[model samples]
Target: MADGCRRRIVLPREPHAELAAVPLVDLLGERLGFSRDTLAEIKLALVEACLNALEYGQGEVEVEVVAHADAPARLEITVTDHGAGFDVSIVPQPDLTAKLHASRKRGWGIELMRHLMDEVEVHSTPGLTRVRLVRKRKEA
Candidate 1:
């Protein structure tokens, strides 16, 4: 691929549709010389972003991946959804103890994305939400 190459994928609002984008990223990451661990982290972060869009969005979901061809290439992924957005600041942190005992254990998507990606940003409004994730290629 050349410098500043971008890949765009649109998935229907269906369960597990987020998985469709994983392989593409995996392939791209491999070609870009990302390590196995880095690739795994990128894939996981991408999954969380896609899941958020699929579960919360009303219509189709759009994923755009940009590979910046620099000395250490990085991937910029943006997941956009058309749905009623919620304030990201209001989301409370997941309590480990409570989650352990609670029957329904979830709500760690944001944290996971933040931990896995170098940068994670959630931009949301009344009818649009965009999750941007970036992971830099680790120096081997």
Candidate 2:
């Protein structure tokens, strides 16, 4: 791994594909000097993104990582799936009060990612969905 490197991984639709994504994050995190807390957050967000891609997406899932050579070293990760997409705008806002009393308790992936990463962008169309997450290492 070099400075300002790019890594891409394509995973099949399997039960443990999400787990497979961990090493990529760990490698980049260690090489890029990500703090323990930041590395944990990135790993969590990546796993959630993979799970969403697997559950709602179709076929295979593709993940791309780019390490930026900047003051803080920005890391951008994109997860893409080939499933039929939906309107990201229509996703309901998560409400703790509502969720606590609801019969079914799920649908927190996007929100969790947003909270964990510095930036989270989701692009979707009729045939594809992509979740992009960006994080910057806090300078020590």
lDDT of 1 by residue, 1-140 (tens): 66437778897656689887887687677777888888888989999889889889877789988877676688888999998998999988899999999997999999889889999999999789999999888776
lDDT of 2 at 123: 94
Q: In model 1, state the lDDT of residue 65.
A: 84
The weakest ten consecutive residues by lDDT in model 1 span 1-10
Against the unseen true structure, what C-alpha lDDT does each candidate score? 0.85, 0.86
In candidate 2, the residue pairs with backbone N, CA or C atoms under 3 Å apart (3 or more residues apart, or in different chains) clash, namely none
Q: Give the Cα-based TM-score of candidate 1 against the true structure.
A: 0.91
Candidate 1 — which residues are off by over 4 angstroms?
A: 1-4
Error of 1 at 30 (Å): 1.7
In model 1, what is the error at residue 53, expressed in angstroms? 0.5
Candidate 2, after superposition: displacement of residue 94 in Å?
1.5
Q: Tell me how far the alpha carbon of residue 123 in candidate 1 is from the true structure, in angstroms, after superposition.
A: 0.4
